[model samples]
Target: MYAAGLLNYSEHPMKVIIDTDAGVDDAVALFLALAAHKDPKCPFEIIGITCVLGNTGVDNVCRNVFTVLDSTGVSNIPVFRGADTPLVQPFIRGESPFFGVDGFGGVHSLPNIPVVKQERTLEKESAPLALVRLAREFQGELTVVALGPCTNLGIAINIDPNFVKNVKELYIMGGNSHGVGNIRPCVEFNFFVDPESAFVVLSAAWNQKIVMVPLETCKLAMSSMEWRKQVLGTIKSSCSISLKKGLLQRFEKDYGSWCSCDAVCMAVLLKPSIISKSSTNYCTVELQGAHTRGQVVVDHPQKTGKPHNVTIIEQIQLAELERMLLSTFHPSTFI
Candidate 1:
């Protein structure tokens, strides 16, 4: 079921750029991406990271990125700031943030974490422009892992139609596959924040491959409460320490399970072999409806007669997902 064209043994190192909102789960996923690169033979070679507004403001997002960099002892990757608002409307969070106002699980903005101004790691160029430039520069070999709203990428495509045309793959952790919603009824948080951008990005005519790890799949990837407290809580690295202290603040205990949605999506992408089921569908975001404004309108069963545009991960191995996430914290634990 893992036949969505991402595997290539000859292509040892896959070039990647992460677009995120720096949520707690995003932090976990970001660290996972960073730590995987520590392995000299790992397939992912992250080119850069782009920040957007989702879990918190873009400024806080930048600060959180720097915090992750500080924890990981990584400095080479450049970070870029992107759209603060959506394409057609402002992003109304509509509720209090689950990952705290700063999206670091309310470490209460621990003083040890370096501010963006202190490290000055953010690039002068904006994220949308950087995205377009990178896609053109990479010339069809760049994989974009978007862990937030599709605003930045949508803006990039609008700036240059060929931006999507030049990209190799896009892995997004957003939307609901079966009308199951997290933030609102029939809507997921990311797509709900920016439905217009979601509509644009998902509906656009693109030659590049798009793989979505939906909220549904992420739910299936959740770890049991025992596993979270015993296995994940026991790891003692900078990343793991951060995870226990701040990253899992509010989300650590939810329905007797730990659901790191973005990290689940990252694990699926990092180890595609864990994908036990997948489907090809023409998916689009609902732009207008009283109750279903941001719902992902996946055309199931060829009802639309449209060519399948995106590959949606339907099922995954929960045990394998745990292994990948555990390795992200303690690199040598798995192998």
Candidate 2:
């Protein structure tokens, strides 16, 4: 029955809005989203791409978004520049040594595509506002896929108490289960980079569905040299070409193969059944603590008595995940 349930969820695709920092894996996630949008079998439509500051500065992230869209030949999907810094912490300006200087390893030049301007007169709202507006417009019909710090989404929830209720589901790529951390012994990069924003977003009262791609499981899904060769070797799109020659080359030289955080996030969006052993827990971010700051403090023992806001994904079937990842790049096999 468990195996059958996973198979069932993999068959349906959901509507998604990807909020990212445009890191190397974020680029791969964007490619996956674009691929799903183009596939007739998968009915996922990328409503928009919002840039945030995590892997790089906000300006560079915005530029990277445009570059990826241009390379993928997708101009209709709007890209919005989000918050430049965290709500409480000082803006830490650091480039991702792992992802290369220009985020996408300078594989493809920054596209000359024109930035999308907002026509609505609400003081030309930021990315968070755009997200709130879209949530209201497509209430209960959209899924929020967050691949970076939760600054924008948290701001949106603060703007309206019922802000997140409009969305059907929320998929977040942060937090660490099993008491392990990627950035530190207790914190992951995404949540640690902006703990205040993460706290606000996770504390919201909306009862909508939530799926968290914890670092515990995501770390296990790392990309191998063989997988990169398979994706770059088989796909023939313009995006794939640049990803193969440029991004993959730098990735192999630097990090061996990309970590699968963003890719697993995209896969979860496409097929939720890839998840197993999810538990409802009350999670909050620790802004204090010198070494443990930005850590996701999960109340598994009901210490807080607060309602569970996060569904922590604990296990994933490796065989099925591998199959899905391979199938995503194969043109003959859709969904």
Candidate 3:
């Protein structure tokens, strides 16, 4: 049974900006965002998408972002390519053998949507400058859904210490509280890949809201064959077909469950009450550990007596998740 509290945010949707790396999971998250945008009850509007480097190269991620948008028949969402690598470090290629050469599991066939060149003027602006401009323009109304390394966000905060105060909140898909890491035994991929950026963002003094979806919570929200079939069944456009085929093939090959880690993050932004959250006394990123570099060190026991900097999601209701997904897939049946 779904918890009553989990269904709380159905009354209103939030304005959001998705910063992603365009992984398969990221694609799922994007779909959830689009679905929310389509819902009349949900007032969420995806202002734009900012691409980063993590699951794949910046170019591949940019392509995947546009491809996913095209497949969903969504246009007019401007995408900006952020930093090509982490702040102050060279780009180290990850083991894509797990996620396919291209982040979307090597889905070759794509929609015939014209490859719209990125708005060069937007590209010319530094990521920090662009973020500041956007925040100022949408002051106190934009929520940033960060689904990858926090490089651009950190830079933005550094550029303008008041940057966080100007926005609504930041929904981040990263960190691991239980010591289980996807990239390393103790380090989650997103934090490990760019500890510096993560540190800067997390430590910033932001009155803006913060919701963190850790690995522990995300692992429990795994995808199954039934879910994949449901998602594929909803495809009526050629772009959707290409994405569905590629996604299915990847899952069949034993790559990974099309887990919606990023999607869950987006879901929380749309409906914050869907998951149970806990307040950590304080949290810091481990950057120099021998085997635990990039691990999110939460002060669970309040040993430091420091003020809380982030709101960590410790548990989520599965029934509520299923309900949300079903409603997103079939909007008319939701009411």
Candidate 4:
């Protein structure tokens, strides 16, 4: 009983570093992780947040990150600014009408949400360097959840050749499968934003494990509009007043179905069983080609000589995922 208690104490609050571009969905992901920090079943203690350029510029990303933290009443999580552009690639800004300029769908700030004053200032160290230092500090237990372009991670790998191998694992929300793409005919937004960085991260050797939750997985695992309305309909009664108001503001301008894409990565970390189907494969990005420039080329080891370097998630349990997402937004509930 004593040994079991010790084990339970050590594992509940898993240490994590969230590297994101801080879009609307990334805000949802951050809130979910913060909520999980309070869960007894499978909590996540956020070590820090590293912001990179993707959905918006690094400045806007930083603001969005801090804004989410403030709204959630989380005061001590350090925020770090990362790479402003992809390595060896020129930045061609992709205008996301849904995400808007400020990266929170242009909603900026919501009233009625209690804002936590900044207690933890931005770290002096840059994102990539901080990642390297943190990996050494936590060694065998740090899990990095990347919700943006892979620039920061690729920089870390380049700076310290062993950086990739030192982390416990990487939960990446990028890439696509079956040649399906969200941004272009053959490219996902994250990989399209920075193909060179994506190539570096996917090609980097890892000592532990790497899980890629691509665009396809999110499309399949998204909460249907019916389910979203049914669950969010109870937000007023189920959640705290402040949290309810915050959710309402964020969801007010929704389209059909609400797929918290970035949040899916966090959910997978909180409950690994949500992923119903996955496979290990070697992935590389195309650096040239008018239409296929940023496309990801996934190669199966069984069919090719390349080594399988990443676990690509193809599908997840939809119903279970819906439950997890709902729980993620509810402060009283645990995923």
Q: Which candidate leads in lDDT?
A: 1
- What is the overall TM-score of model 3 with all chains considered together? 0.84
lDDT of 4 at 48: 85
Q: What are the per-residue Cα lDDT tens digits for candidate 2 across 147-167?
A: 999888888888877677887
Model 1: lowest-lDDT 10 consecutive positions? 1-10
- State the lDDT of candidate 4 residue by residue for 85-118, as single tens digits: 8899777775543466666655555455444556
Off by over 4 Å in 4: 1-13, 40-43, 233-255, 301-303, 331-335
lDDT of 3 by residue, 1-335 (tens): 22212333556556678888887778767866776665555667888788888888777888888776665556666778787788866657756544566787777454553333333323555555777778888888888889988888988887888788888788899988778797788788888778889988888877643678998888787666666566634534333423455456645555355456787887777777777765654788887888987899888888888788888887776656766655444423212
**Colliding pairs, model 1:** none
Pitting candidate 1 against candidate 3, the one with the higher lDDT is 1
In terms of TM-score, which candidate is strongest? 1
Q: Which residue runs of candidate 2 sit more than 4 Å off their true CA positions?
A: 1-13, 94-96, 109-125, 229-236, 241-258, 330-335
lDDT of candidates 1 onward, in order: 0.80, 0.71, 0.72, 0.74
Across residues 1-335, which tens digit of lDDT does each residue of candidate 1 receive? 22112222223458899999997879888877876665555666888999999999999998888877767777788999998899998876646688878877655234443323235557999999999999999987888999999999999989999988888888999998999898887799999999999888887777754899998888888787778878777776555535654445455455457878888788777877778999989898888898999999988877999888899998898887776666667734222
The lDDT, on a scale of 0 to 1, for candidate 4 is: 0.74
TM-score of 2: 0.83
Per-residue lDDT, model 4, residue 26, is 84
Which residue ranges in model 1 land beyond 4 Å of their true spot? 1-12, 108-118, 245-249, 252-254, 331-335
If ranked by lDDT, best first, what sequence of candidates would result? 1, 4, 3, 2
Candidate structures ordered by TM-score, highest first: 1, 4, 3, 2
TM-score of each: 0.90, 0.83, 0.84, 0.87
lDDT: worst 10-residue window of model 3: 113-122
